[model samples]
Every structure is written in structure tokens, then in C-alpha cells.
Target chain A: MIAQFPALQVVIPLLGAPLCIILRRGALPWLIALLVSWAALAMAATLLSQVADGEIISYALGGWLAPLGIEYRIDTLNAFMLLLVAGTSSAVLPFAYKSVAKEIPQDRHYLFYSGFLLMLTGLLGMAITGDAFNVFVFIEISSLSSYAMIAMGRDRRALSAAFTYLVMGTVGATFFLIGVGLIYAVTGTLNMADLAERLPPLYQSRTVLAAFAFISVGILLKLALFPLHLWLPNAYTYAPSVVTAFLAATATKVAIYLLLRFGYTVFGAEFVFNIVPASEVLLTLALAGVIIASFVAIFQSDVKRLLAYSSVAQIGYIILGISYANVTGLTASIVHIFNHAVTKGALFLVMGCVAYAAGACRLESFAGLGKRMPLTMAAFVIAGLSLIGVPLTAGFISKWYLVLGAMEKGWWPVAAVILATSLLAAVYVWRVVEIAYFRDAPADAPPLSDPPLALLVPTWVLTGACVYFGIETSLSLGFAEQAAIQLMGGG
Target chain B: MKHHLIPRVIAKLTIPGILLFALYVQFHGDYGPGGGFQAGVIFGAGFILYGLVFGLENLRKVAPPQIVTAFIAVGVLLYGGVGVVSQILGANYLDYDVLSAVDHDGQHLGILLVELGVGITVAAVMMTIFMTFAGRLR
Candidate 1:
């Protein structure tokens, strides 16, 4: 039973999605989603602990061998990701009851939960699956479900936003498929482990190089890296608050994991870095993404849109870490995956509460919110501080590693840019803080207090984790270091 | 239009045959090219043709929307349930060899059941989508 954790990790939620539709009751589907997510988190914990020593667990679906069958592979990297994604879902679900009920129509609530579970299944499956084709399948599953969930937002713009994402995301997926097909054409294998073994000898082949290019661009678009990030701000802005929270936290993080897996494990660091100069390209883009996206974020009027752009900038920092392509750089990349997830997830959830009580996620709605929703805003502040890479917060730990990584390479300019971007982070984060804390309530405005305990508790829980993971460092840092070492050692 | 006797009569004549062929495709999936997805679409097309020629209300009388939605859930659960059953029997998820005393028979039974699940879902979903867009006209 314990050995089957990898299969069960994905299978449980895949089944739970249908169960949600079958039940079709108001609270029943939500409860089912909540349970399935918590179960996934628990399983992830067990999987992580089991793989903490850098061991790998591979489970073959349908009892077929790995070269042919769909395999669920869990290593320290993905197990940690599974933990982040599932844990974020679990935290966000408890907060969803009020926010979802407030935003979405009553009739669609069951469908909403069903979509949530499907998205969870897709994200977790992507993290755990060892097959290249299976990653594409899970990416579609997660993207399709998310498009539906995003379209569920009350505003009609949600429809167009979803359509925009649909088009861009489909193109991205197609490019990735073409890349994978190219690789399979050359190597005749879809298994990541097998592909790694076969890929090195063919690294100089043009087909393999084109395959690498397509796959990198496809994943970059999905990851919402700077130039390719047009679909994200609106999708995140218009999505129902819970959808934004969950997708913001986990979806792109999984894409980053996919990028790292392909870039380091399958393609091999030597091919990606030394032979192809992929590191230099990625490093340049990362710098531009952080500076430009942060500039864009500070100008947005809507709070959700602002945070959405901030998310793009944050993704830049992650890519910045990745572009360094060393042990410390990879560690920063991995730890930031967990750090940014908790911080941004908490921030979006807090916005969800604001949306529930104030009826908008715009900056104007946040006026005098500090007095009314002190605790919620407080959680927002702490998570906001974390986003700025303030000391004794999770975001700080990521930046610390990122700076060290840049310095280790004697890239002093890159290290300076990392610090400069943190100030940009401070600007965007402070925008909301200023409105919430300094501005006075309008005369005709109704009184708003903290949201229900159900909402506040989950928001704080994630917020507290931002600080806790910062100070404690063992669970997230230990696993991140282990994952970094394993990736560097090759799959 | 109900007044179109020729179209209605042709639909009636061919729908049964279409359904029959769908069944054949579903059952022979393990050996042939036609499987759950293709079989399911063929089966659903028969009903969709009926709804188009005979009117949605008449189609609704024969197959309600609620039941169609329920069947979608049922199909997925059925498919997933088979995998769980295999797992409980100490094989990995979807390991069909443990489903019966004979390994070959278990694999056959497993494929057949899974295809059946897919057929049911695709058929129901096809009809549901037809009804939704077709009903939107009224």
C-alpha cells in the first residue's frame, strides 16, 4: 500500500473529480475536493520523507514496464512539488467555501469543485508522471479545467480572458507536443529515464536541437516568462479568486519543474549549458523579465491584475535562478518554487477575502481595509513582505540563495540586479499596503470587518508558513538542497 | 421538422443499425481499430440524429438530461473503479491479470469493461452537448 503512493497520489484525485460530479450536492463536492487534496498532501509528505535521502520511486501504471507504460516517478524534486501543489490546494480549499459561494453562481458550485479536482489531478499528475507524452496530457487536463474555472468568474471579460488563454495555451501545448514527437522520432522512447540514456549521443543532431528549442519555448510560454506572459495577467485577474489562488501558486511552478526536468535531467546540463549556451539566453531573459514585469505590475489599477503581473516578475526571479544552472542556482530555483507558492497563494487568497467582503479586487475597494479587515490585511502584509524578499521570510531565503548563486559565478552585475528587483517587489507590494493602511474609508462605504474564520484561518495558515519556512528552513530547505543535488547528479 | 417524413423515417431506419454497429465496434475493440472513443461517437450520433429529426422534446422523453449527466459520471467511475478493483487484488492500478483465473481472459475482460465505460461516457456527453446547443434554439 505504501509503495503504491505514486499511483495513488494521482489516481485518488482523478477519481475524486468524477465523484464530485456524481454527488452534485452543494457542500458534498467541496468536502470531497478538500479531502482528496488533504489526502494528496499527506501522501506527498510520505513520498517526500521516503525520498528525502534522494531515492526515487517509480510506479508503472497497469503493471507494464517503464519503457512502454505510463510511469509515476517521484524523486526529491517532484515529491517536494507534489507537496507544494497539494498543500496549496488543501489550504486554498478551506478558504474557497465562502469566496466561491460569494463569487460564482449557486448552480455552478458543484461544477466548480469538479474543475478544481480535475485541475489538481492534472497538476499533480504532471509533477509525478515520468513519461513525456503523459506530461502533455496532464498539461492539457490542468489547462482545460483551469480555462473552465477561469471562465466561471462573474465578469463577462472572464470569457474573453479564458478564450485568450485557450488560444495561447493550445499553441504552447502543440509546440511541446511537436518537440516531444521529434524526440520520440529520434530516440523512439517517451520515458524520461530512457530518454536521458538515449539523448546525449544525439545532442549535436539538428532534430534534437529543434526539439529542445520547441520544448523550451513551449514551457516558457506556459511558465509565463516575460515575453510570452501576455495570457497570464488577464487570466489571473479575471479568474474566480480561488482559481487564481490555486493556479497562481502551483500551476506555473509545475511548468518550472518540467523545464528543469527536461533541461537538466533529460537533455543533460552539459548540452543545455556548455554546448547550446541555453544558460546565457535564459539568464538574459530572466533579467529582463524581472525588471520589466515588475515595472508593469506597479501600474495596474486592479489589485488582482497587479498581483498577476507581480507573479510574472516573480517567475522571472525563478528563471533567473535557473539560468545560473549550478547547484546553488538550482537550489534557489527549487526553494523559490515552494516559497513563492505559499507567499503568492496567501496573497491571492487574501484578495479573495477582500473580493468577498468588498465586492471588488481593485485598489479602490481596499481603501481603509486596514482598519476593517486588519487580520486579513495583516496576513497580506506579511506575505507581501515575504514577496519583497524581506528578512526572516520564505522569499528572503530564495533571494539569499539566488544572490549567492550569482556571486558564486562571480557575476556581480547579476547579483546586483537581484537586489534591485527586490526593491521593485517592494514597490508593487507597498501599493496595496498603502491603500489598505493609509487611505481613509469613504463616507458612504459600508463597514467591513475581517472575513469569517473559515477564510481568515486558511489565509493566516499560509501566511504563517511564509514566516515559519523562513525561520525553520529544514523541511523546505533540506528537501530543496536534496533535490538540487539529485538534479545535478543527473536523473 | 416533424412534418419531414422522409428524414424522420430514414433516421428511424438507420439509427438502430448505427447503434448495432457501435456495439460491434465496442465489443471488438481489443482486436480491431474501433474502440471506445470511436464506438461511443458512433453510438451518440444515432441519438443526435434522432434529436435533430424527431425534435429535442421527443429525444428528452427518451433520454433525460439528468440521466445523461449522471451517465457521464457513471462511465468515469466505472473506468476508474476497474483500476481500483485491480489494485485491491494486489496488482498495480489497471493490472488486469488478477481480474480472472486466466491471464488472457482477465486482460480481455479488462479492456472490454474499460471500452464500455468510454462508450457510455462519450455517448452521453455527445447527446448532452447536442441537447444543450439544439435546445438553445428554442
Candidate 2:
């Protein structure tokens, strides 16, 4: 069991999903999924310990040596990612039981759980796998399942959202495949470690540069970076609450992980930074995404859609860190990954709770939610404040590192830009705070109460996580630093 | 959905052949750019052909959508199952050599099982997606 930790990290959800369908009656599937997710979390914990202690665990598929066979590589970065993904799934599954039954039809309940499990499988697999092509395969797995999961929403907009995601996802996947193909054509290898070793020699090759371009574009689209983020707002707005929460926490996080893996692990900083000037493009787009998307978020009438735009802005903070192209920059970006996941996951889950209680969650619907659904709205306020980078919160920690990294590079303007964007976040969050707390509920509305514990527990779990990770830096930042050093080739 | 022969036969022969080719690619994964994923899709294509030629109803009779979906889960589980087996054997995930007394031959078997898992999942997922879309068409 100890030796098989890598496989267990992915296998639990991959296998547990069918068991969900089979044991569809009663609360069994949820229980199974919960147990399996915990198992995965345990595996991740063990892997994290091993990696943090500076041990790299590479599991050979069927005992074939790497550069020839599929492998599950565990280092500090991916181990942390696996923990985030599995931890989120475990956290979310407990909440999904009643929430899903309320949102989805009874007969299709089994299908929904199964799809959820598969999506989990795809995400965790992508995070943990070392093979390049395997990432694409898992991307399809997660993407296809996610499309189905999102489409299961009661609203007709769900279908259109799913369709739009499908088209965009297909395009992203195609780009990723082309990039993989190009890399393979150049080096005849698909393993990340092998690619990293082989790619430096070919740094001057136009073909390698083309591959880098394709991969960056593909990841940018997937991460919903700046101008490429058109598909995200609708998908988030229209998806079933559970689906929205899951994707908010895990999906984009995984894509960011891909970008990190490629930029730092596969391409190496020297070549990627010095050769192609990738950081300049990343920086420009990050700034645009942060400023522009924040403004867009401010005007949205629908609360969920507002947060969706806000997500694009958050993505900018992560990209800005990466574009700095140093240990501090990479660490900052990585820290934000965990921070944003905590913030967004809590925010969206609270939104789901609001939707459940009020049967609506637009800006107007939330006009007096603070008074009616006090705890839920309070959770939202806390998470929203964190997103604004308030001191003593997870979001601030990320922004702090980002600013330091920028200042270290003597890019004071970039540091100023980071401060300015944090202000944008404050404005949008304040808008929501004003509406939810200050205004009046419609006279026709019935008195609303707190959402059930099933939902609120997970909501608070992440809320607690945001503060806990903020106060206790050892878990989040330490892992991120180790991951950064590892990506910089164990500096 | 009703079954029609021309399309069915074409689906049966072509889809099965494509699946076989996918398996070949998966087995030859180390030597080439393809592996478990291609095999999974090809296998999926075969079952999809079965559904196409025999009518989804008839195919459902053979492997119902619910059951097909279950099978898809089973396939991934089977892959994971191998990992568990390796754990029980006190080795790392998918350690095939431990599965067999032979050295590298165990790895051969391990890869085969893992590929089979991917093949099953890919095949079943295709069927599941097909069922969803075909229903929409209806």
C-alpha cells in the first residue's frame, strides 16, 4: 500500500465512480466516493511527505523503464497538486449528496455521480501522470465528463454552456495534441523528464519554439487566461452548483499546474525565459486579464457570472508570478494556486447555498441575503475579502509574494500593477458586499434560513482552509517552495 | 433506435478493426507515440459500432447503457486494481514483474492489463457519449 501510493492517488476515484453507479441506491454512492476520496487524500499525504523530505517517487508502469513506459512521477509540486485535487473532491463529495439530489433529477442521480467521479479521475490523473500524451488523454477524459456534468443542469443554458465548452475544449485539446506531436517529432520522446533533458539541446530549433508556442496557447486557453477566457463565465454561471464548485476548485488549478510543469519542468527556465521571451507575453496578458476582467466582473448582474469574470482576474495574478521567471516568482504563482482554489471554492459553494435557499442568486436576489442567510453570506464576505487580498488571508499571502518577486526583479511598475489589480478586486467584492448587506429584500420574499450542514460544512471547510493555510505557512508555502526548487532542477 | 445492416456491418467490421489497431498502438506504446488512450478509444469505437449496427436498443440488450457506463468504471478500476495488486505484493503501483515470477515479463503482463483497462474505459466512454448524443438526436 505504501509503495502503491502514486497509483492509489488516481485509482480511488477512477474506480470508485462505477461503484457509485452500482450502489446507486440510498447514500451508498456518496459514501463510497467519500471513502475513496479520503483514500486518495491519504495517498496524497504520504506522497507529499516523501516529496517534502526530498525523495522523488517514480512508479514504473508494469515495470518498464522510463522513456519507454508510462510512469507516475511524484515530486513536491505534483504531490501538492494531487493533495489539492483529492482534498477538494473529498471535501466536495460530502456536500454533493443533498445538493445534487435537489438540483438533478432522481433517476439520473447515478449518472451524475458517475460523471463526477470520472471528472475527478481525469483531473487527478492529469496532475499525477508524467507522460505527455497521457495528459492529453486525461484532459479529454475530464473534459468530456465535465461537459456531461455541466449539461445536466436544469437550465437550457446548461446545454449551450456545455456546447460552448465542448467547442473550446476541443480546440484546446487539439492545440495540446499538436504541441505534443511537435515535441515528439523533434525528440521522439513523450515523457516530461525526458523532454526536459532532451529539449535544452534543441532550444534554438524553430520546431521546438513552435511547439512551445502551441503548448502555451493551448494552456492559456485551458486556464482561461485573459482574452482566451470567453467560454468560462457562461460555463460557470450555468453549470449545476456542484459542477461549478468542483471546476472552480480543481479544473483551472490543474491547467495552471500544466503551465507550471511545462515552463519550469519540461522547458527549463533558462531556455524558456532567455530564449523565447515568454515572460514578457505572459506579463502583458496577465496585467490585461487582471485589470480588464476585474472591470467586467464589476458590472455583471448575475452573481455567479460576476465571480466567473473574477476568476479570469485571479488567473492573472498566477500568471504574473510565473512571468517573473525566478524562484520567488514561481513560488508566488504556486502559492496563489492553492490560495485562489481555497477562495474560489468557498465562494462558489456559498453561492450554491444561496441559490438553494432563495431559488436565485443574481445581484438583485442577494440584495438582503446578508440579513436572511447570515452565515452563508458571511462566508461569502470572508472569502470575497480574501480574494481582495486582505491581510491575514490566503489571497494576501499570494499577492505579497508576487509583489516581492516583482520588486526583487526591480520591476516596480509591475509591483504597482499588482497593487492596482488588488484594488480592482476590492471594488468588485465591495459591490457584492454592498448589495448583499446594505439593500432590502423584495417584500414578496419568504424568510430564508441557513443552508443544510451537508453544504455548509464543506463551505466552511474551505473557508477554514483559507485562513488555516494563511496562518500556517508550513503546509502551503513550504510545499510550493520545494516544488519551485525542484522545477528549477533541484536548486 | 432500430438496427440497419449496411451501416451495422460497416460499423462492426471497421470499428472492430479500428479497435484492434488501437490495441496494437497501445501495446506498441513504448516504441511509438500512442498508448492506453488510443487503445481505449479504438475499443470504444468497436462497441460503438455494435451500438450503431445493432441499434442502440439491441446493443443495450447486449450491453445496456447503464451497464456500459458501469463497464467503463470497471475498466479504470481494473487499471487501479492492478496498482492495488502491486501494493499487496509489496511493490510500487503497476509493478508487473512481481505479478509474474519472471523479471521483465511481469512488466509485459502489467502493461497489457493496464492497456486493457484503458481500452475498456475508452470504449465504454464512447458508448456513453454516443448514447447521450443519440438520445438528443431522437
Best by lDDT: 1
- Model no. 1, DockQ: 0.81
Candidate 1, residues A1-491, lDDT tens digits: the string is: 88778888988999898888889877998999999999999999999999988789989999998999988888999999999999999999999998898898888888899899999999999999999999999999999999999999878999999999999999999999999999999999999999999999998999999999999999999999989999999999999999999999999999999999999888999899988878988988888999999999999999999999999999999999889889999999999999999999999999898988888988888999999999989999999999999999999999999999999999989999989988988998899999999998898999899899999999999999999989999998888988999999996
Candidates' chain A TM-scores: 0.99, 0.98
- The docking category that best describes candidate 1 is high
TM-score (C-alpha) between model 1 and the true structure = 0.99
Best by TM-score: 1
TM-score of predicted structure 2, chain A:
0.98
- Which residue pairs in model 1 clash with each other? none
For candidate 2, what is the DockQ? Answer: 0.47
Candidates' lDDT values, in order? 0.93, 0.86
Of the candidates shown, which would achieve the greatest DockQ relative to the real structure?
1
List the candidate 2 regions with Cα displacement exceeding 4 Å.
B1-65, B102-138
